[model samples]
Target: MSHRQVMKVLSGLLLGMFVAILSSTVVSTALPRIVADLGGGQSAYTWVVTASLLSMTASTPLWGKLADLAGKKVLVQSAIVIFVLASAGAGLAQSTGVLIAFRAVQGIGVGGLVALAQVILASIVPPRERGRYSGYFGATFAVATVGGPLLGGVITDTPGLGWRWCFYVGVPFAVIALAVLQRTLRLPAARRPDVRVDWLGALLVAASVCLLLVWVTLAGDSYAWASWQTAAMVGGSVLLGLLFVRVEARAADPVMPLWLFRNRTIALSALASLFVGVAMFGSTVFLSQYFQLARGESPTTAGVMTIPMIAGLFASSTVSGLVITRTGRWKAWLVAGGTLVTAGLGLLGTMRYDTAYWQLAVYMGLLGTGIGMMMQNLVLATQNQVSAEQLGAASSSVTFFRSLGGAVGVSALGAALSGRVSHYVEEGMAAAGIPQSGAAGGGAIPDLGSLPGPVRQVIESSYGHGIADVHLYAAPLALVALLLVLAVREVPLGRRAVGE
Candidate 1:
């Protein structure tokens, strides 16, 4: 492809990725409203999100592998098409079950968009030049992250443009991305003949992930931590996980190459990504609820409130990426990112129902700065260490772990919040001498709009307190990541030759 064509294709990929990411993040603020209207409880709400995550996790490596064997352009275009269709289906869904199913389809497309975009970029751009462009990709992701909730909130809060619009919003963008990819993306096919995909490994991994996520979602909510249900689910997950690992070891082309675990950089990057995913997805996913329900902010205002974090992300990623490009040093940034993330969580942990919005914004900025410095750089650093032959496997491995972490984090945190909120609400009701029958049906938190002002405030406070407590859970995860990052040896940055 010509340079002009490459830029066009790059633009399309970035836009497509933006839409995919935005769909997920933007829906967060709108979810509580969506769930209440659809008549579901907290478990249903978590499933709506978890279903998408589970599908995305299962399909991500498959997409990466396909990019290597078939063609990046074809996979990316197909993904955009799927995304549009699913987005429409989700928008039209009348029941929570249908919405979750459609969202799962969207997640599959998301997996494709995310994995192939990176693979295509690697195909076209040399690694040295890659850093310069990575800043752009990171910025795109950051903007989507910031814009999603804000846009979701505005759309939800606007009469006649309710939560359903959150799903509908991405369709036009997907169409544009499709047109751009068709017109601009061109590439030589992989030199080798196609090989068989490891369907068995894929199946095993999916089953294992599903089982584990189910365990996380149910543990401590539907059952006690040590109950029979918990034991059965945990044991089943471990067994299936071990079987998946064994299958990967012997497969001709495993979805996850077991050998990549041998690379120290890849290993550490994967581990750090686990923490980053938990901290990033686990925390950010809940913030819209915190702001809108807990802090009495309108959806639009809540979206606007998140800008500090986005700004921090944009500033830190662009600046750090450029500096690394110039100085050929990345480890310091990694250390800094981990430190900032840990500190951000520590600050957020101190939040209460009465905490100031500006204070929350400051903590958020620190969090975004930490994430911007870490997320993409970890993948870039891993790519730097591996040979080109292993690039797809290596890169996908990092993403796979990240997705796994996200799945685990979202499920675990959702379960934790459900438990905490239920406990707190019960305590508040008892203290207020309110009868359980007077509250809304189901022990789940009430809709902010339906409750009496005092009841709403109590519920909101419970959520704020619950959200703040989760950060303590997140903080240590980040600190552990920081220590792991310290052991990663720095590599000099430069333009990578093809197949280096």
Candidate 2:
């Protein structure tokens, strides 16, 4: 394909990608308001985010397998339709239950989009020249990641417009992406007739993940972690996972092929992504709450505060991509990124509600820079190690694990934060000689603007210290990721002819 042709296809691909990324992050700022309006506790707040991630993680491998057998254009269009309908449904939801259901449906489509965009790109662009295009993709992602939160905040804060518009806003973007793909995307080959899907493997994978997430999300809040409920869920999940391994080993077309792990690059990248998932998604998802509940910032102001992180992401991804293209070196960037992530998370762990804004900005910048350098390069590195035949499976496997890590990290960290806040609130109440009955229950998520002055201080301080505690827990995970990155052997850049 010529440069102009690549741009035409990229225009649609980028827009579709923006929708996926935007849908996930936009809700972060609006979540507190959503939970308050819908009347849920802290666990519900985490489940809203975790539900989407769970569905996305569970479906990614199936979507990747489908992409290989199904026509890419048709699959892409189907995903867009699914996403648009789900988004509309989510916007219309009157209850947390309904919203979570819609978000899960929306995640099915997101899984497809996330896996397909890169798989298709790998098909069209040779790995050597892919750096330039990948940079464009990375920049588009950075913009969406930053823009979604602000946009969601603005929409939610706008009187009479409300938080529902955050869900509705993706409709127009989805429509545009569908039209662009219809007009511009061209496939290289016809769909094969002999392809078969490993339905049992898909089922097993979903069952295991769902069971485990159920335990992870509900154990501490709904029941004791050491009870029969935990035994049932954890044991059931392990058995299902084992069955999935057995099924995949024998299936003609495994949704998640077990053999892919035999490749060193794939194994390393997937492991690194798993740890990065815990570090990146676990810590950052709470920033909106930090600004609002801790610092007492409005929704829009909280959105704006995230710009420092975005700036670092944009600068590092753009600069590192261009440099890698010129020098044909990427491993050094990965190592530096892992190191930065560990350092950044470690620094962020010490912050509390009263921590200065400038210090927060610096810490976020370092973390963002680390993510920018690492995320895409890992995928790029994995792609370089395989033949084109394995691209879909290989790429999607990495993504699936990363999403898994995110789902687990979010659920676990949210629970941890909630527990810490409850403890702190109890301590504060004791020191101030306030009756225990007057203190808000630990699970309560209240509107900051409506609280009495003294009560608000207690809530904010609890949140501040609690969120920081989660960061402290996550820093070592980032260090684990850094260690994994050091183990990844550098593979040579692809010298395959461009536009093959």
Among the numbered candidates, top TM-score falls to 2
Which pairs clash in model 1?
Answer: 26-148
After TM-score superposition, the amount by which residue 58's alpha carbon in candidate 1 deviates from its true location, in angstroms, is 1.4
TM-scores for the candidates: 0.96, 0.97
- In model 1, the Cα lDDT at residue 240 comes to 88
TM-score, prediction 2: 0.97
Model 1 bad stretches (over 4 Å): 1-6, 440-443
Off by over 4 Å in 2: 497-499
- Cα distance off (Å), candidate 1, residue 68: 1.6
Candidate 2 lDDT tens digits, 63-135: 8888777788888788888988999999999998999899899989998998888888888887876776777
Task: Check candidate 2 and list the clashing pairs.
Answer: none
Model 1 local distance difference test score: 0.82
Best by lDDT: 2
Worst 10 residues of 1 by lDDT: 436-445
